[model samples]
Target: MTDPRQLAFAHRRSADQDRLQPAHHPVVIVGAGPVGLAAALGFAARGQASTVIDRKASLSDGNRAICWSKRTLEIMDRLGAAEALLDKGVTWRTGKVFLDDRLIYTFDLLPEAGHRMPAFVNLQQFLFEHYAIEAAKRTGLVDLRWQEDVTGIEPTTDGALLSITTPVGSYRILADWVIAADGARSTLRRLMGLGFEGRVFADQFLICDIHIKMDRPVERWFWFDPPFNRGRSALLHRQAGDVWRLDFQVGSEADRDAEVKPENVAKRVRAMLGEDIDFTFEWISLYRFQSRRLKRFRHGRVLFAGDAAHQMSPFGARGGNSGVQDADNLVWKLDLVLRDQAPERLLDSYDAERIPAADENLLNTTRSTDFIAPKSMASRILRDGVLALAASEPFARRLVNSGRLSVAATYDGSPLNTPDGFTAGDCPTTRPGAAALDAPLSDGWLLAALDRGFTSAWFCAEGISADALARMEAASARTTLPVKPLIVSDATACTRYGAASTPACFLFRPDGYIAARWRSIPPDAIAAALARATGR
Candidate 1:
């Protein structure tokens, strides 16, 4: 086995680069947003030539997203900058719900064992992007092009060709493939003629980012006042350095015609404070959240990611999290195809897996939003009742926490998935379509060897021979990914894991879903599974 990169180079004499350009880009990602940066990181780490271009000369305002899940932080760490970002962000252990001044229930994002950060943390979206871009820059594979926008696109049989315009002039960007992460008004998505379905809110809300100090006991809080006003005002969250993200529902009568008045928003917050709490303001704007999603994510040479694919209210942090997931799903497949290890059909799975997820997540986030709407009489009644019910009972608190927000996303019946069964490659172990349950997610590749209890190795056991392991080591010299083999020994453990019942190996995708699995390992079997899993 040769290093895929070297193998690709060697085969270059036999292969035509002209055909794959744009389609076979070293890698070209459009959008410097978090998802784009993350994709760039994944590509660079995988030994691909990557370029990231954005129409905006600078980064985002970073106002929209601020929450990071434990799993997300774990990924950032692997990319090598989680600590730097985590250190500056606020670690939220608990969030409390209140009906006006009455406290109801508090939810804690306790660490789920083997995790360094809490289940969730609140950081300014811009700040997180900064760390990611900086880390991505260090890989040196990231070619940041600000003010570089894709004005025209034409996918040829060979690859994707795009007319990218910069501050100076326009040039042709030929990529093996193109990643569309430019956001909700995605020009690429429109050009691909993909329809974004679902609905937007009829009522618009005022989004005000302010600096406020409260004498209120709660460090983080959600306030609802139903009888007083039927407008929903959410305390988006507390950000780093004590700044707060706040949203107040505006009256329908006042301002559909007029621009959102900053002073009026500030006055409303001051009025809501009731007391003379010291406060300084930062930023203010109007936002009407929509729950929109693309009917199709991939068409021919283009793939949609981030806001380009789905649109959701910033309710349960679904918008940002799901976008990252889009990146996660698309990056690996892109890596494989660019390396010439898989067929183009692998790209199709991106839509099949992610669109459904977007719909489900949109449902959950909106339901949570409705539950916490802060304005409706019914929601107010429900919030008050739940708070009082949860005050003295432990189970009730758990019910509330687990009921609305979820720690991770699970793929059900994905194109890359198979029925759950006990075999050499069952999910509870390191089998395909499975992520490690419980603590200490291995820093390297983890295989659930079911021989004695359970064991793991960085390498796969091909023929169960030392020579094979040595050969694997030799092969790895060229490839960058360490194929750690975790071999299990205990029969009881083996039987429990299903690998004992079936002798096979399974490889998981980056999102912890199984990419490929088999009763046995063969190039053809692996290739078939990879093709189906990737949807290329």
Candidate 2:
């Protein structure tokens, strides 16, 4: 068949313009992928306009990243694209693991009820990007310049100077800040001579997306040393549009080009299916696993995010999810600093917070990679033994590492969080520096009540002192900074949030991470916490 990538482009082409005119923008993003577009939307949500430049003429064609975690969906929701994505995506909460065609175990993600988003959604990366691109366009705050390639990046005294080459010609842009959301092969990272250090595994993995009519349940299926392929691992996941993604552990010795050929791909599919089954190949690619990251994400005014800041093996589905989180973490800080609501020093916290997150993702992916692709014969033997024991032993089942999947990375030691001083019998569902857990409220979930800035949640009894309420309201009205006060009246909400004790309060940052909590509503204490949260 015909290559889908060669078809007519869907995005608007860049029009010719005068090259000598230099442009200036508050923020210029050097990539239009999901992460970059989401970053633009993040800025747009905060009334910050950004220009998004991408080398590609349109969204990607293949199904690159298929799994989006709950936190990612929340970030998309904040950007106004989550509903659109959920409508077009396939939602799955169950997974099955097998050892050589023998069923080892089955697990369910157990998505919580009343939460605004599910645990995970399986959608093609291209389709998600399409949704993001359209959302960015609707905002009118994002200037998306397609076919614009960023060739050079120079850190300026104020921010950064970027050299962009488009179909018209090369042009220079001066911006107060620049975000490099470019993918793994980031042009800005390369031009800046940044080093991404890590390990490269020896095994090669082949990913194929096929359009076929299959009765397989909507769940993740992972096989170790399956009958179709001896001594190799395989993964099968269902995507929307009746497309299925299959991954095979093709050893390093296999030729990459030969493995992706239609005949070779057909041979592998035929092995999985019987001689009578029918399927059409949509896309195929070969990739080797790697865990690498930059030492720091912020270099002067140019901030790196997504695959540009960190790279990890795909075993955990952390690649895209973590990238989206990176965007989420940086945008709020960028907005704060740009709006002068927070000091420039506040930007350093982005590095401190997200670097650790990247490290955690790298560690998880590394463990999954080691488990899936044992380095030595002894290791492989141990792996097989564990798999064998997992079939019968309950304890061994916990040790099986088919792919840890993705979850929200907590900023345990984040400097932005105000430590909880007052204690209760139960732990607060949302801890300091942890992503706020969604809970059913009287009208909506807790996440929906949060603002884009600092939100102070006051859980009080039916009748509160008017003086105390006045103090809290006065603190909220102090500035134009993104700060809001929310009161929880229902007793169920108070109990569920572990704030049943009268006057319990929780402070959350714009990204939904809890910044601080108080057992009693103290006007002075809340003001101090907000001051520190905004880098006062």
Q: Give the candidate number with the greatest TM-score.
A: 2
The regions of model 2 sitting more than 4 angstroms off are 1-21, 422-429, 460-471, 474-482, 489-492, 500-503
RMSD of 1: 8.7
Q: Which runs of model 1 end up more than 4 angstroms from their true locations?
A: 1-24, 212-220, 226-231, 251-259, 273-275, 373-403, 423-438, 441-482, 487-507, 514-536
lDDT of every predicted structure (CA atoms): 0.61, 0.84
Best by lDDT: 2
Question: Any idea how many clashes model 1 has?
Answer: 47
lDDT of 2: 0.84
Tens-digit lDDT string for candidate 1 (242-303): 67877666644457535367656656676666547677776677777687887788766677
- Candidate 2 residue-wise lDDT at 58: 57
